[model samples]
Target: MGRRSDHSPDELRELLVLSGHALMGERGFAKFSAREAARRAGYSVGTIYNVFGGLDSYLIAINSRTFRQWGAWLEAALIDAPSDRAGRIEALVRAYFGFAQNNQNVWMAIYDHRIDRSIEIASEDDAAREGLTSIVDREVASTLGLNDNDARRLVRSLIATVHGHCALWLTGSYALLEEKDPAGQAVDRVLEILTHHLTPSES
Candidate 1:
């Protein structure tokens, strides 16, 4: 036989998402195309429609997958954090860097304004944001005893810091720093700053 060919519709959809992510990472959203995504995913144009309804829907599905992966990684990392406040904050910071390193492309896509423009065409963007908000609310805020507003603010700050750090790292601005474990030290310092802000006494 040529191959086993065991892929189901769900499996094929997942593959399409993976392929779309790869293309977006390599050439970005403006340059990515449905035909290219289908080719890379080992599917036909018709199959892409069957799985996602259309090109815009397919891109939304891909973006949703990226958010889902991010949420899962965050949840797993938080679950293993120490119960103490400081320890939990440190774990969260480390988890941020860990996710950046492991999913640099997807992370870039998540924050890239170029890709954000695609949100106008699909409803999945809102779903992805909701999923992310849930993680931030439960794992980051609830663990630290903050109210919903504080949690959202703190999480936004943390995300902003990580995004700046990751963007610089990706653009080679941290080449010298990278020579000495830049990401680790950067994450530690971020955790220190955030923890100080989140301290009960500071409230």
Candidate 2:
């Protein structure tokens, strides 16, 4: 017979994930440990393994949850944003910067951790990852009136541009700029440049 656990498997997994998330939020990916998570959860190390298989799996779970939570936050922030194409796009970009700043450790961890290829993806996990992409796609499609293919391409470019600006801002690349919010100014400048390329029909 299998060893009995005080908490059900599902409950134990959630507890482990929650604890792991707290640890990562404090120390980020570099310092997070399954042992610490187990301690936080008041479960034995063996129990964490039983719940999540290993630390990598637990980390992946945390990353997955992070994506879902981030997506929801972005969605809520966009709700009250202006419906005009340019306004909405700018809002989305600003929201991205805020999210990155507020959750620097957790947000970065999404890209910091590398998952094994052999690990099977759950449907919800895939959906969580796609949620952010879909938001951008929807906005791009509506704003540019482009087909799905073109909108996807544009979304990818827009995301790259936003990420580049944010990354540069994080590295203090815009420190000397005259603008009060260098990152915001960078975002506006990049958007202006990209918008300039749009022909009448494309917009």
Candidate 3:
């Protein structure tokens, strides 16, 4: 029974996060307060404070979960790719866009400033930068022939391209991938361009 009660805190926290997502998705973060989230979660405002320091912490928790989910999806996509490097890049790009479409609110929360600023949430910019560096260091630089600095630069470029394309797609600025199936084609085009730029010439 103790363990059952012990699990309640975590379960309640998850409920709060889910409620936060919905509220934030509907009204934007600034309009959504702790009381609102607590009400949505069917809990007391004090309960919310018990779980999270404030709305900022709650939003951070939600965004962190989103990042972890996206990262895991990308990692699996990379692992499931064909042996070729280009194939891996293509898989990564496809997975990213798929995640964007499937998790639009979360994607927007991470990308769009207006939405993010509402919650007073700090950008995940540094975390993303560090993550990009790790991917380049472990996967690209070490596995390939590139030095650390070059690998970091290349990874930065790739991240920029992905974010740019994803931002356009998420904001409906580009109608090219508005539909479900068009995402693969869009990713393929981006992968082709990246491959052409990154693949070394035959001696």
Q: Please, what is the whole-model Cα lDDT of each candidate in the order they appear? A: 0.69, 0.76, 0.65
Better by lDDT, candidate 3 or 1: 1
lDDT tens string, model 3, 1-203?
12335447779778888887777667654465767877877776877667876655676777666776777777777787887666666677778787877887766776433334445444653474366336534554444445667667766776666677677767777554555555565566556655544547521
Which numbered prediction scores highest in lDDT against the true structure?
2
Q: Per-residue lDDT tens digits of candidate 2, residues 65-153?
A: 98888887889879989987677777888888888789888887887788889887677778888888888877665566456687677
Full-model lDDT, candidate 1: 0.69
Residues 55-93 of candidate 1: C-alpha lDDT, one tens digit per residue: 767777777877887778878998889997667666766
Q: After superposing candidate 1 on the true structure, give the runs of residues whose Cα lies further than 4 Å from its correct spot.
A: 1-15, 22-33, 45-56, 113-124, 143-147, 174-179, 195-203
Stretches of candidate 3 above 4 Å error? 1-12, 22-33, 113-139, 174-203
Clash pairs for candidate 1:
none
* Candidate 3 lDDT for residue 59: 67
- Candidate 3 clashing pairs? none
TM-scores, in order shown? 0.69, 0.84, 0.69
RMSD for each of the candidates: 4.7, 3.3, 5.2
Residue 134 shift from truth in candidate 3, angstroms: 3.8
lDDT of 2: 0.76
For candidate 3, the per-residue lDDT at 150 reads 69
